[model samples]
Every structure is written in structure tokens, then in C-alpha cells.
Target: MLAGAARPRMPASAARSRLVEPLSGETRLMLRAAQLYYRLNLTQDQVGERLGVSRFKVGRLLDRALRESAVRIEIVHPAARLVELEDELTDRFGLGGAVVVDVASTGSEQDDELLARERVAGAAAVHLASLQPTGAIGVSWGRTMLEVAAHLRPGWTAATEIVQLNGATSQSARPTRAHEIVERFGATSGAAIRLMAAPAIVGTPGLRDALEQDPSVGETLAAARAAQTAVFSMGVLGPESVHVASGYLGATDLAALGEAGAVGDILGRFVTRAGGIALPSLDRRTIGLPLEELRAKTLTVGVVAGAGRGPIALAALRVGCVRVLVTDEATASWVLDHA
Candidate 1:
């Protein structure tokens, strides 16, 4: 060795590039120490003593191994496809606005939690906040709709009146109460809430006729009919569905709906898979804007999700019930595939 020459300190064992490489007993023991120290939250000294290495050597090996392993991390933002999907749906449907969320299935609990967090309520709240404030806004009721109402931003406009598009009632205690929904929207928008205080389903046609004659209900219905924009969701059939859960439909009611060949319902009007509104029963008792009136609105925004609802949503689209649609990517792709 040359005089005054410094010697580099070499590792006791050769560094293994791949984790699968044959490691010496000491190297293997060092790796185990590093894992125990870092992963298991033990101190370097504790890991070193446990693995029979000096604390200094244990620390050096841990640092070198981690550096060589080089775990690549990345955070992907929401894709431009989201905005493109919005634009495409808007152009195709002549919608005022559209919001499409990315709820792609990742086959994980975290993904499901993330999907649930993408509620239509937040999107609707944002949409309502940006409204131009011109005409009355009609609203329909459902769990998704109620979620929208809850997220609505407060103090929008006092002049902007909210009209309920359907009667508020059900067999159970908590029916599709339009008053609660309307009031929530009113509170958010600072607008007058007009509620149709009638049963969702009356006992008889005679009773329905008598209820419609009430001036208060008639006035509210008129307001709903004249509204330029309406927001609603397509309801699926079944016991645990939103309608059933909201107490708007009992088992017998659902059976009757099924017998009527209803694939889904919109504003309590049963419709087929082809989007033809069936069930004269809906026409007789419901105190709200008719299908024709709903169709006439300049903007009829339908917010719905789930693979099961894709058919109903497509049917609604085919029938021109929805001029604007807000949904997740899974449902959109399903609609296109099925279409």
C-alpha cells in the first residue's frame, strides 16, 4: 500500500442486487434485522443486537438496501377522460351541465369507500351553486336526491323558488317526503319551497280527485309544471331499493308494479325497459307534473348510478326524459355496451 493512501471500507458480504439472490448468513440476518427494525417499528440497536450485528453496521446495510430497492411511487390525477365524458354526454343529450365520476372497480375496500365518497350530492351542490338564476327549479325526491339537498350550498338566491315534482307520502312512517327535501333545498338556495302535501298513493281514485282539488296542492302542481329545469333519479325495483327503503313502496306495491311490467320508475310513474311510461295508476293519484310536462322542461337532469340502474337510465335517455345525465364511468360504459 502507498504511504498516506486511504483504504475504502468494503461490506463484509457482497451486496445482492435482487432480493432472490443467495445471501450469506450474516447478510440474510442483516436483512431480517432491517425488516424488523423498519417494518416492525423497532430501533436500530434493538434490531442489530437481535440479529448479532453492530448497530452501526445494521444502520448502514438498512440504508444501502433501501436505496438499491428503489420503490417507485406515483400519484395519478383524475383523467381528462372524465371531462371528455362530461362533454360527450352534454352534446349528445343537450344538457346544461354534466358531472361524471370515476368509480372504476379496483377490487378493494378502499376503492369502494372512495366510490361512496363520490356522491351525486356534492356534484349537484356544485352545479346549483353555479346556476344562472332564471326560472323555478323543480326537484324530485329519493335517497340520492336527499343527499344532494343536504350538500346544497346555502344563501343562493331568495327569488329562486323550489317546487316539488311529486306528492310526499308512503305506507311506512318516512315516505318520500317532498316537504323535507324541498325545505332542505330552500335552506341551501334561500328560496321559497313549495310542497305538495298529499299521499304518494291514495286509497282510491275518488280520494285522489278530491285531494287534487285542494287549492294549495293545485297551486304547487302548477308551479312544478311550469318549472324550466327538473332534477330526478331513476328508481330501480326490488325490496331493498331506494323507493322501498324510503317507504314509498311496500311489498304489495312492488308486486303490483312488477305485474304492470315495470322495469323501473320515474317520479312514481312505472316505465318499461324501453322507457315507455306505463301504469295508469300513477296518472290517477300522483299530484305533480305529468310526463309531458317534465319532458317540456328546458333541462331535465337525471342523476343515477350502479350497474343495475344502467338499463333504466338508458331507457330514460331513449325516451328523452333526461336531457342531462350525471353518473359514474361503470354505468356509462355499461349503457354504451348495452346500447
Candidate 2:
């Protein structure tokens, strides 16, 4: 008989009651500790007395039960986030705040990618709405930003203004949806919308300056500069990048950027692995908020998701451009592990 399963004289029927193998002494102790500590809500000292062991041993047994899968704990919430990951991100990156969306894989890479973006966008929308800003909010245009705008509810915030942070005019046949994103944000928040009516990039630096001097564009840029909060998304350098698709960049331009060690882009400005600008001349022609200005904002919210975006996200955090971050669990973990 096992140490705890003492045997005594019993009826034949009682002896035959053993229908399954007995648990090992250690396994039995672990289960008992888990039951007493968790189910019974007993203190370690009390459990130790019942189990004839020290309180230290009881704690170890409880830990073992959790580690060996003898016990499981789940947070029963539909939109529960990983608070541990959020804490780790905020602490590790020196961020003001961090939100890690717990996204489950959908068994397909493409679908999973889309789901991750939607989850992050939803979280971003919630975070933004909670701020309840009554002033201008600088914003950028992208699919992720559009998703964020869609997630926002009407009357989410009142007396707010939306200022476009970057030029949205795309040279490609594909629309950038720049106007739509800010319009939706303004409509949802019941705020005034100021759109940047200019190309993201021009043929020359001189042309870019001329456009910036235009009254409407100049007013919008001034509004962006005065805004205390900025919300934006990032893009990884690839053929599928919106910059490439928008015709602001072509194959050779991307190749040159890659050669300069760019990992990704923020606010139409590309940066290297260490977050330094990859190409200054290209930045000179791009019309938007200067990258350095992002760090000066009272709040800068960065929303990014999907695989292969860790490098860029990490770069953004390191550069101090992202005071508040909203991303998927995988991306948050990758940033912490690599940071």
C-alpha cells in the first residue's frame, strides 16, 4: 500500500473497490495542496498542518501542481488581455502605457494576420476613447488606422478635433483612404476634421516646399503641430507595403532603402534597425509631421500588428516615438524578448 493509502481489515467488496491505479505519493500531495489552497481557500500554514508538512513544502507542492499541469487557472473574459505581458512591455520599454491584445491564431496565416490587426485596432480604439480628449488629435492614414476608426463608436469623444499628420495623396491607382479615415474619426468623435490636402511625396524638394506653403496645407500642418495627442501605425519594408503600393516608392527606392538598413516606416519616414532615419533626402520630400516631433507630444499612440513587424515596432519603441503602444501578444512578446 502507498504511504497515505493505509490498508486495514475490510470486507471483500471493500477490497475490490480499487478500480484504478493509485496516485504516487508526490502526486497525491500536490493535488491535496492544490485542493486545500485553491478549492478550500486554506492558508499554507493551515494546509501544512493537515498534510503533516511545513508551510514551505506546502507552497512548493502547490507550485508544482501548477507547473506540472495538475492545476489550471483561466481568466474568464471575452476580451481579456495579457496583463503580465502589458506590464513587461511598459517596464522593459519605458513606455507610459502598453496594451497587449491576446489574439488566438485562426489556423491560416492570412486570416490570422487580419485578425491580429483587427484585435490590435480594437484595443487602440478603446484606449483612445478612454482618453476623452477635447483637443486636436493628430492622425495618420493606413489600413490599421482605418480599422481603428471603424472600431470607434459614435460620441466616443466630444469637442475633439482630428488633424491629418501626413499627406495622403497616393500616386498609384489604389486609393490611400486618407480622407475617409480622418472623416470617420471626426464623425465618430463629433470633432472638426482637418485633412492634409497634398501629395505624400513630390517630384522634388522644391515642389514639396511649395505645397507646404499653400494656405490649406499649411493650416493643417500647423494644426498637426499644435495637437497634443498623435495616433499612428507603422509599415514594414516589403513589396506589399502601402508605400510601395501607393507609388510613393518603387522597386529601386525600396532596394536603396533596404541598403541603407531601414527596418520600417512611421509617418512616411523610414528608419533603420536602431531607429535613425535611413534616408534624409527622401524625408525632405515627404509631407507630414517631422519624425522628431512625435516624441514631443503629450501622448503618442502606436498601433501595429501581424508577423514580421517586430523589428519595426521595436525600433519605434526604442526611439521614444511610441509613448503608448497597442499590439498583439506575439508582437509584444517579440519586442520584450528582443529588447
Candidate 3:
């Protein structure tokens, strides 16, 4: 597991609730407390000093010669040997943390790229599952997040609140990929569901403002904005982007954005090389939390990988849109090259 730098993750909820169920309750409690304090890195106070016995015994256990040597430490090597890459990314960006995945072997360059995306997506899935996140989780829509949500297996993150950070778009008669991604997250985590029933980008700023004030949309937006942790990915400026394929944007719009020096996006809102919105007119009608709102979140994570994304990833890091990142070796190297 790659721990993000500096930012606090949810404490081990599973460990805290456990109890000694056997006759020697005192002995078991002391051992568990010692494990928490020494091996698991919980603070001494978190092991509970109240009443003295737990703390005193735990202190004694910590002083024992074994010092957790009895417990075997196993290093499970991943397909992508990337701890060094992950560490480099975090150190360079001053990120909360980073997860770097090794690509599955493939015969062709195209196949390698596809496998790399899958590997990074899988890593993101594992990291999110590790959070065992409680309370509200805000999510953004795009190919990258879709990849992460698709790879997520059934998990123990029970009864979480998952809200979409952006509105939905429909290309065909089927449900939008954005809705599908958020729904899968809720189902995998066994969380409560709240979906936004609006378009991602409206025709005009007036229409966008009106929809933002509509009670149903407004309430969902408020819940997402108030979320303690959020997971999103940037959409690069291109024809193959999820927005274009999902009918949220057209080629002309992309061309216009490129002409105006747009690089990428957090939700539907676009940013430039310097990372702030480059096109005020387009952003005025975009329906989602603004860049500043996302930047302020401590646990906001960006899960992205692959081509034509390095510039945007760098911009997102520089702008503080995401505190944590899950990526692959190639993309990580590319970002470092430009850094």
C-alpha cells in the first residue's frame, strides 16, 4: 500500500473496534494495544491511557525484546514494481501520496499502453478500498475514474455516501458512463446513492445558474462540495476524451478550448498550463464544483494514467486540484521529464 505523504488517512477503524473475546481478556488487550502502538503506528493515547491498565501493560509489552519481531513481514510484489516511482512522484509534487502501478507485459506499444492504464486503474481501486472510507465521498466523471470504478471489486467500505461531482450526459439511450461509474462505486462499497439528474454543461451561463439553484441539483451539489474525501481525474483536451464521446462536448468546443490554451479539467471545468480556468465564458456554464473548491479538499485524489495527459497532470499538481495521485510508470516518468 502506498501511503500518501503528510495527509492523514482514516485511522484503522477495524482495529479500534476489536476486543478480547476470550477468558484472558487482560492479556489479549495488552497484546493488541502493543501491536497498535508499536507496529501499527497508532499514537499511545489512541491505545487509551484512561484507567491505567491498558496503557501500562501496553508500555511493558512495547519494552519486550521481540518488539514485533514475532510477526512476519511479507512483501507482496505487484506486477508494477513502482515504489521508487511512487515515492519520486510524491516527493516532487509535495503530494499527500502516490500509487504507481507496473504495466502488464504486452507485445505491442498499443497493447502496452492499454495494459498500463488497466494497471494504474487497478492500483487506484486497491488504494480506495484500503480507505474503508466512511461518510460522504465526492466523485468526478471521466474515462480515468470510469476505469478505477470498473476495476473496484466488492469491498468492506460499508454505508458510505457517494455523490457525483458533475451532472450526467447521454450519448445513446443507455445510462451515461458518469452515472454508471458512480453507481458501481456505491454498489462495490455498499454505500447510499445520490445521483445528480442534470446535464454536465448547459447552453448558457444563465441556464447553468438556474439549474445550480434548482433544489434537487443544488442539494446534491452541496453534499458533494461538503464531502470530506473526493476522487476525480482530469480530462485532456482531445477528440477522444470522455466528454466528446459521451456527447457532452463537440469537436468545435475542443478546438476552441485548445485555441484558448486549455489543458485539462477536474470535472467539466477546464484549466490551462498555469492551472486556473483559461476560458471564463466556457467555465461560466460548466456545472460542477470549481477548481478552488476541489483544491481545498485534503483527501482529494486524482486517479489518471496514459497518453496526452502529462501536461494536465502536471498542471493539476501545480494547482493543488488533487492531493493524492494514482498513476503508471510511463506517465510518471513523462511528468518528471517535464518537471
Candidate 4:
């Protein structure tokens, strides 16, 4: 080998002895920036100062790290028992779907109201949206139904119609009590709404006969008869129940109902323990669709909750009043275990 020329290049290991072992300043700064930016949660300027580089360089390094897929983020939801409860309800009731919300035992009044309203509305929206392009959809009124109306979707175009199964009175708070619900259905599906303007309860059986003769109310009642699907809630007897809460029944009226072996009600008509509609005196005056007419529909969904309502729900199921039911977990469990 020549003296000036390298001695035929020592082995590769010998070459390493002449090379630098430490990383370059730029390489070290890039790694330091990555750690500070992601792990330490420092600003670009702060990371740059620690690495003795400009903030611009630190920003570039972060961008590179992200682009190279060096960082990954993930999120997971905590497991809950509500899912199991939902499944149990669907299977037991033979329902197409179900949702059970977690309500605090000592939750505030406002919270409870919000929870009830939200659940009812959510269920209504889903069911209404899934209606066939051409069919009748019947609705009944109560606090829960009112809340459901409040949350109904604003616009729809599914080719349907809204028929009021029950009457709303002139003495009532509003002639359009169920107007929001019908309007929502109409808006979303472009369906016509048939309005029933007769009083839910008239002065007398004679008065009811006179009102039913009105063309407008008669037409709405006819539409209700042809309904293919209906949505309603079970009513409980007494002053604290929804009927009383909605001011449809006064204190004395409720007392009278209790004396008649009325345990619950549906669409303002009282029901017996066996779920048969009672109140021979008031039946003729009641303007809602008949129980048999409702049964004729292809789908009848009844949404109800509360532990005290289990018996009525069971009775409704027994009498073939409700083929599809949407209820809370506690109520659903009680119905399956007890009813």
C-alpha cells in the first residue's frame, strides 16, 4: 500500500474509529422538540429555547412528527349497565327498539322533567321518521306526548298524514294542543294534518252528539279510523296522574273515577283491571278513537314509565291494547318479573 493512500482501507470497524459517535445538533433538537411538544405540553417557543433552536424550527418538527404518524390518539367510553337493561327490555317486550336512560333516584325536579321529555321525544322522532310513505299516524296527548312534540324534527317529507285520535276542547288551554306534534309530522313528511276541534269532554252526552255532527271534527274522526299506526301513553288514576296533571280531571272528578274501579286510563277513557275501557256514562262523550279501532291498526306503540304504572302496563298488554311498548328499565323489569 502507498504511504499517502489509505492502507487498502482497514476493515469497516476501523473506519468507525475515525467517524463522530454523537448525533448532530439538528437531529438532537428535533427529538427534544418532539418530547417537549407532546409529552411535556410546552409551547413552541419554550421547546425551542430548551433545544436552542428557533420557534419556527420547533413548529416544523411537530408538523413532521404528525405527518409521519409518530403520534396517535384514542378514546374509549366507560362500560355501563344501561346497555344490558336496554337489551332485556327489547327481548321481553318483543319490540323493534328500546332505550333506557339513567335517572338519579334523588334527581332534581327539573332534571326528572328534562329526562322524561327527552326520552319520550327521542322515541317519537325515531318512530315517526320510519313511517311508511303513505299511511295514517295517530297521536294522543299528555305531558309526555307534549314534550315529545316539542322535540320533534322541524322538517320532513315522507308522504304521510297526522290524525288526532282524541279531541281538544275550546275551554282547554289551546285549540292547538296537539298542533305542534301534527305540524312536526306534516313538516317532515309533507303530510296533511286532520284536526279535531271538539271538546275532549263535553257538557253532556247530548252535547257530544251535537259536536260530532260538525264536518271538521267528523272528518278528523274518520281519518283516525283509517289510521295504520298510533302512538299513545297510559294514564294513571287519581289527582297526581297525568290526566289530573294536565287539568283534564279535577279533584272531584278523579275521586269519582277512583270509585268506579278505575286503575288507569288511555286517551281520557278509564280502564279496568283487565284493561277493558270502563265509564259507561262518559264513553259516548269521549272523542278519542275507540279501543277496537286502535287495535285494528297494524302498529300500536304505548310509551310509559314509573314504577307505580307496572300493573296498568301489564293490563294493557294483556288486553291487546299495546303491541309495542317503550318504557324505562325499572318499569320494564317490574313488568317482566311481576306482571
Candidate 5:
């Protein structure tokens, strides 16, 4: 019969297990054919030789066996477990994406935590490198972000520009190679670095506003505003946090912010429990991309890990601080469990 435009749909039974487990004696010729070929991984020639048939017939049997759904296949992947958490984060937080690294638990809890952090950093580095960045990438300075930069391999991105999202030229209480972090990012991505030459936090709002108008600072801010992707991390509120350790804040100041409901710091600004800046006065003195601006960027990636960061990480996610997240399994589980 010549083919026609309208053909009757094949019945479901035609493509079921009827070919292998035949319903009638007429279809039982290949009953054990798929078993001999697929189960034993036999070559078509070998299957044909054993069945006393030509290789061509053996191939036909295998094709019919597939159409009849005789053999079912499933693939298992090492990273399959991360997909569940990834989906939950996407559905729960409306995030662009999530990358969760599963690090094996070590005998020592303390050492395991550190090892997980390093693995997360390495994963973040790989993720960033995979971007093939072509334009301005705004990066803020922080402990986690610095580690990410350190682990980044060269040539992950090309013909790119690395913009400093916040002012970071000021002196820290302790020695911190903050600039080195941005430099490594540039070196790895083959991007040119645009340093923001100003204090991260100035003495007064008036002085901070004045510096914003400076030609160099204005250039850096413009680059940041035009950035296509921005990578940053949240800072925990504690004496040992980089912010406090670097003298961005004193112990007494942290106490005051906590008293005012500050849960953590992002981009040097304290975040309240309600997901707003904790203190307006402190924000005024902070020299960085405005919170609203940072949030509005298309690709704001928050790279963080560790149990202690869960509360702040959840706070940031709730407030639309970051669109993507890269962290270890423990941190992801913590955020999902606690958030």
C-alpha cells in the first residue's frame, strides 16, 4: 500500500513487550532473542551464530525488541544526588541556578569543615571558569570570594574586564591581600582589572559622597553598574569575620548592629532580620555598589559555605541578594532545613 497523509496511530500494545513476551505463537520467534543479545552483551554476529541465523536477522530482532520495550535502561551519575537540592533551591528561592558540591565527611569534624570549604571554593572556581565571560564581571572582596579567586585556573574567561564592585583600597587592621584576589580573577579570566581606589568605609557620609564623585571612583562605579555578572559573598557578624578582623567595624559597633536586629553583612552593609539594611547611618559611610544596584544585576552569584553562614545566606536569598549560589552539601542542606 502506498503511504497516505493520514495514517492510523499505532496501538499501544504494538510497542509494548509483545515482541519479546509474545501474546500469540506467531510472534514468539524472538522470545529469547533480546535476552541472549542484550542481557549477555553478545555481538550481533555471535547472537546470529548461536541462533543459526544471519547477522541481519539478529539486528532486526534487536530493533523489534526495542520497539516492544523489552529492555529498559537507566543511567546513574555521581552527581545525581545534587539535583534534588538544586531543584529545591530553584523552586523555593526563584534562583537562576544552584551548584552544590558533595564532599565526603572526614574523621575530624573541624578538618572536615575546612576541607568542605576548600572543595566548595574549587567548585566555584570551576563554575566561574565555565562561564567564558566576555564582558565586565563585578567582583567584591571577601574571605570566600578570595578563596574562589585563588582556586580559579587561568583562561577560564577571555577578552573580559574585571571590575571592583566596592571600594577596597583602604588599610585593614590586619594584613589582607584583598587586591590580590581581584588580580587573580583577572589573570585567570584574561580580563583587565579596574581597581576602585577609595576607602571601603570612610569616616563620614559626607566624605564618602564626596569621594564617589572623584573621577577614578566614578569610573569604577560606572564599570560596576554596567557589569553583566557580579560575584560576591555575605559576611557573618562576628569578631572574627573579615569585616571585624579587618577593622571595618569594632566589637562595640557589632554589638550595636546586633541590638538593632542586624543578622549579617553583605557588601559591607549590615542586613536586618527583615531583609533590609540594618542601619542607614552605617550604609551612608560604606563605599560600594548600592544594595539595590547589586541586587538588580542579572547574574549575582553568592559563593559561601559552612554551617555558621546558613542564617545569613538564607537572609540574603530571601531578600533577592543573589540569583545563583555555589556551596557545599552541608551548607545547602542547612539553608534548606533552616530557611
Candidate 6:
């Protein structure tokens, strides 16, 4: 059945439908399919019959329509998730994709942070799992990454390899949980793990050079560079940051980094608001893949939560270190508003 010469009448089920945007060709067909399946309350078979195609083809077209924005579904409810925020973040930041998790305050600041972290991590884990990633995946170690690992289901990937993107040896007695983060990701995926057994920052550039020269460290760094996909978290510059808590940096160092316009750290390397190295001296002692290398990766998913994390997240997006972002609603809104 062709969409013929006669002006098509809006079906009874389409009373609430409206054409808000212009489309043509395949997009027009997509919109038609969407209208038939959604507004007209037609099943895939019915829609396909009207459109003169197989039901399987209709399914693919409907999926493509949603992906291409031929149709937009808005959920209206008291607790409706703000799906638009994800689109806005991707558009505003030029991101490849975004996942925004709905998070409500839990009354206590501590509980709220914990809940938000879990929500954001769960979203990231699901997104990663959906990708069906294989081969070497570069990852960073931190609280956020740990949460992400915890949320990942078994066999998230097949025959994958996990490479630590940066040195994780903490200067303090408190555990960085760095190894645990990589190991957990590897264990779930049945992957081969390559750990960077060294401090994130050494006392001097020469010491950093000597450590990188080691075969084990060099091999891991090489794998990190070659991996096309990476997942990590942005670290806000603050007293509560993992670097400070793990003793990789101290109060005086944080003060220096702040004075240098550092907004956050990516892969343990602090960067400015404009995504430039915040401090050359500090970065020289840092052991990890350079910030510029991140831009070349096929996928770099940055998972960050908490209101205070907005600046770093924005910096990561602007710098092109992160292609996809998984974060809570408040943080996403904050990034969009501030960006």
C-alpha cells in the first residue's frame, strides 16, 4: 500500500500527535513508522503491513528512528527521569554519548554521595556491558572505578584484557583500592589484567623515567596506549579527593594545583579548566598515559558523580578526554549550566 495521492487522515489513535519538526526521505518513512507504531497504537506487524515491509524491518526502522531522533518519547510523571538532559549534555559538550542517572537526595550528605555514586556506577556498568567490549580496555583506579567494577556483571566482555592506565602505588597507608579495581573488572570479564605497580607520581622526573624503563611498567603502559577503549573517573581538586586521601598529593600540593588553575585530574594527571596540564613540574613526575593521548581513543567513558564533580567533568568533555559520560542528574545539569 503506497502513501497515495489523497491527503492521509490522522488516525483516531493519533489525536495527541503533532508534527513539530520537518523530515524527508528515510526520515519521513521513519516518522511514519513511529507514528503508526506509537501514536496509532499499531503493533510491529500492523505497522509493517501499512508501510509495505516485513515486521522485522519495521523493528529495525523503529530503533533507527529513535536513534536518529525521528521520534522523541517523553515520560510524564512525578519521578520522571530527565532523558532530555542526556541529549543536552551530548549536544552541548560535543560528546559521542551520555548517560544521566536520576538521583534524589537521601537527607544525609554522606548517604546522598554514596547513593549517587552507586547510581552513577550502576549506569556506567550497564552502559559498558551494553557495548560488548572486547580486546584491551584501559582503566584507571579510584573510588568511582571501584564502584563501577562492583556493579559490572559477570562476563561483561569476552576474552578481554584490562590494562591499568596509570601508576597506583599510594603514598599513604590507606588503600587506594587501585589493584582491586582492575582485578575486579578482569575477574568479572575473565580478562587478562596488566597492573602498573608503581606510584602515580614520583619525587622527580628521573625517578619516574627509571620506573617507566622497567619492563613490567613499560609493557602495561604500552598496552594502555594501544587500547582503543578506556574507562575512568574525573577527580575534583579538593581536600576530599582520592589523591589527597591516598597521600599521592598533600594539602600544599592541592593549594599549588588550585593556584595553577587545576580543576581536576584525569588518569592521575591534573589538568586545567581548559584541559591543559595544570602544572608541568607535577606532571613530569606523573606516571601514566598523557592527556593528549586520550583524544585518540575510540571510546573513553568517564564516570563521575556528586555536585562538586561538575567542573572536572566539564573539563574532561571540553578537553576531549571523554567521549561518553555517565553521571548523576545534578552533576549533568551543573556541567551543562556551567559549560
Q: Write the per-residue lDDT of candidate 3 for residues 97-201, one digit (tens) a residue.
A: 898777766778777767777778888888887766678889987767778888889874664799988887665444457888889989988887778778887
Question: For this target, which candidate reaches the highest lDDT against the unseen true structure?
Answer: 2
> Which digits, one per residue and each the tens of the lDDT, describe model 1 over residues 49-145?
8877788988887876677663222335676777777877677656666777777576885655345335655676666566645578888887767
Give stretches of model 5 more than 4 Å off. 1-78
What are the per-residue Cα lDDT tens digits for candidate 4 across 1-339? 347765575578866865866666665667778889889999999998988889998999888767765655543343255566567656765655555554545467666655754575576556555544357778887666776666666553354788878876545443436666666666666678876787676657887777776787888888888887787877678666755554566777667667777778777677777677667676676777878788777877787766566667766666676766766656666677765
What TM-score, computed on C-alpha atoms, does each candidate reach?
Answer: 0.69, 0.80, 0.73, 0.66, 0.75, 0.77
Put down candidate 5 lDDT per residue, 217-307, tens digits, no spaces: 9889989999978888777787777777677777778888888788787777888756788888888998879979988987888888775
Candidates in order have lDDT scores of 0.72, 0.89, 0.78, 0.69, 0.81, 0.88
Query: Which regions of candidate 3 deviate over 4 angstroms?
Result: 1-81, 171-175
Range of the 10 consecutive residues with the lowest summed lDDT in candidate 4: 71-80
| Residue ranges of candidate 6 with Cα displaced over 4 Å | 1-81
lDDT of 4 at 136: 77
Q: Write the per-residue lDDT of candidate 2 for residues 1-339, one digit (tens) a residue.
A: 347665657778765658654767988988888899999999999999999999999999988888988898988775555788888889888888999998899899999999999999999999888877668899999889999999999988764799999998875798899999999999987899999999787768888888888887999999999999999999999899998889888888889899999999999889998989998888888898998898899999999999989999999997889989999988988888888
**Model 1, backbone clash pairs (residues 3+ apart or across chains), number:** 0
CA shift of 268, model 5, Å: 1.2
Residue 40: error of model 6 in Å?
A: 13
Write the number of the candidate with greater TM-score, choosing between 1 and 5.
Answer: 5
Query: Each model's RMSD to truth, in Å?
Result: 12.4, 7.5, 19.0, 13.1, 10.7, 11.5
- In candidate 3 the C-alpha lDDT for residue 73 amounts to 51
Q: Report the C-alpha lDDT of model 6 over 128-232, residue by residue, as the tens digit.
A: 999877789999988889999999999888747999999988758787888998999999999999999899988899999988989879999999999989999
Candidate 3 has a TM-score of 0.73
Q: Candidate order by lDDT, highest to lowest?
A: 2, 6, 5, 3, 1, 4
Backbone clash pairs in model 5 (N, Cα, C under 3 Å; residues 3+ apart or in different chains), count: 0
By lDDT, is 1 or 2 better?
2
> Weakest 10 consecutive residues, lDDT, candidate 1?
68-77
